[model samples]
Target: MFNELLKERLLDAHLEFFRKDKKKFLIHRILYAVIVAMLYAMVIMVIKMPIWLIGFPAAFFIGWKFAYLKLLSTKKNIDIKNSFLFPQFLQSFIALLPSSGNVYQTLKATLNYTPDPLDKELIKLIQKIENGNDRNAYLAFADYIGSSEAYMVMNMIYQFSEQGVEKESIQELERYIQNLQENKVDELIQHKMNASDKFGLFPILISLFLVIGFAGVIFMHYMTNVTDALNTMPK
Candidate 1:
């Protein structure tokens, strides 16, 4: 009975914390709320100390930073990391496939010929379209992929599905796909360069210096203010 009650409590807590967006943001929000509530209860019931109240906002800041770091780690999950490599290969495979008369056939051909982390996602798109979903569904799926290049390519495909397919349209689509792939590669390279900048350590060191310097200045000012207020008191 006790275990069942604990499980229910945990589930309720999870539902309260859960969000459709980044789970990290939800986690951080929940953590900050819980911490603030606990702190409030403690102040009312246990320690009525002033010093503890000052730490409340700091708790939120720390929780948010930790949540962001956690979200970054999740973004590097196996499927997402594989997505970074799969797009080029998938594009190449799609180019090599024999000309299919319809865009849907072309997608099916690509799915059959290419195997990648994106394959499952593509298959789902195909199923959705087959099940009579509108062209925009595929576009939305591409958007969910969170790749601008993919979105562009998918948007073009959506346009083809709207207008009757033609050889010229297919050629244009191919050209656009190649261009998008190139842009993806360029973006990947830029990301790597940005990552390399992290190894320089300058940003981290400067941030630490600023934080320590600010804290010291605040402490000194606080002491000076307290001293002045005490002196102004009539002897």
Candidate 2:
């Protein structure tokens, strides 16, 4: 019961870090840590090691895993913000612009279907535009996301707002933005493939090590028994 509550609290804290829903990821991380700690404790108990020996390493492992999970989650969030979602956003914005005829109307129409983090940022930008703070809105958005794709999108919007919408230029920019997004997606896919390969090898390596270790222990035991039987034989 106590562990369950602690896990819930940790997940809640993690959820607070992102504008989007990360509860599922947080729960998975917390559960992973707990299971790992429990296995560590079980190993120590089986080895007849002092219970106190489990505390420090278990705590450290939990903390390390949590930090790792946080790092991965943050990277995934950045990827989604800059690469995955932004391209779709740009496409939508570009498509809506020719019809909506203005940055504000385009953003407002896009917001109706946009998801969180992006949606929230768009809301802020819309508010800033409404209050006649276009400069600050652009700056705030660029700084908040700190994504190159976001910067490009914002620049495109700024240009459209100033120079009037040109369909050809907008289409060209959209295609370029989409290409960048595709490249990013490719890089991410390659990274995941590499990681999968590494993970695949890891289990095999661990199994080999365990087998060798257990075999050594059995061999040593067998030799000891043989030596004792020889010594006890009639001579």
Candidate 3:
């Protein structure tokens, strides 16, 4: 079950760059996780902290989270690549629609022009079309893109071919897609800024909490000592 989940994550992340070394990748991640847990356990032991009380689980959780961070970073990179290429790919498809006059033909013509990741998916889509699925293949391709804007663009392309929409409308959609790409870029930047701020704030929050906790402990100890002294002296 865990292996299946990992496989699904790899696929979702579109880490085709790691296709050849998937087993090695899995092995390395597992080893890294184990090493992290072991090092943490040793740290706890050196500090004389009891492992039976939450130490081991915390170490494992830390290790798992750190390993998963690698996956998250890889997915972010792939997503960025796709976002950068998608607008251009859409324009290429739109350009060919007049010549090809059908969605499948337009995509086949666009395949050579398409870049990596998108090209790979295009190849699959073409195969699905050849397999007799027709419109279903096209609709599924939209969903497979895993982007809402991409889905809309693809569906619009299909509608254009089916309904024979005006060239000006196609050109307008092209402009809209270009603007969409620009907006997506701005949104990505904003999200990154928000993430940076959160990450920046997290350490400060942790530090403040730690300081308060230590101060509370010291204050309690001091108050207890004072109370004992007062009790002995007067009463």
Q: Which candidate is the best by TM-score?
A: 2
C-alpha lDDT values of all predictions: 0.64, 0.73, 0.74
Q: What is the C-alpha RMSD of each candidate to the true structure, in Å?
A: 10.5, 7.2, 6.5
List, residue by residue over 9-28, the lDDT tens digit for candidate 3: 55433445445356666676
lDDT of 1 by residue, 1-235 (tens): 2343324333333333333354655666678667755666577557666667667766555554444444344544633654465465446535743566666777787776555566776787888889774867777667546666667767767776668666686687677667766866887799889978987788899999999999999999999999999999999
RMSD of 3: 6.5
Superposition error at 195 for model 2 (Å): 3.4
| TM-scores, one per candidate | 0.52, 0.65, 0.60
Candidate with top lDDT is 3
Residue-level lDDT tens digits of model 2 in 154-200:
87787777688887888788788778668878977998999899999
Judge candidate 3 at residue 129 and give its lDDT: 68
Considering summed lDDT, which 10 consecutive residues are worst modelled in model 1?
11-20
* Residue 107 lDDT, candidate 3, scale 0-100: 82
Ranking by TM-score: 2, 3, 1
Candidate 2 matches the true fold with a TM-score of: 0.65
Off by over 4 Å in 2: 1-72, 75-82, 230-235
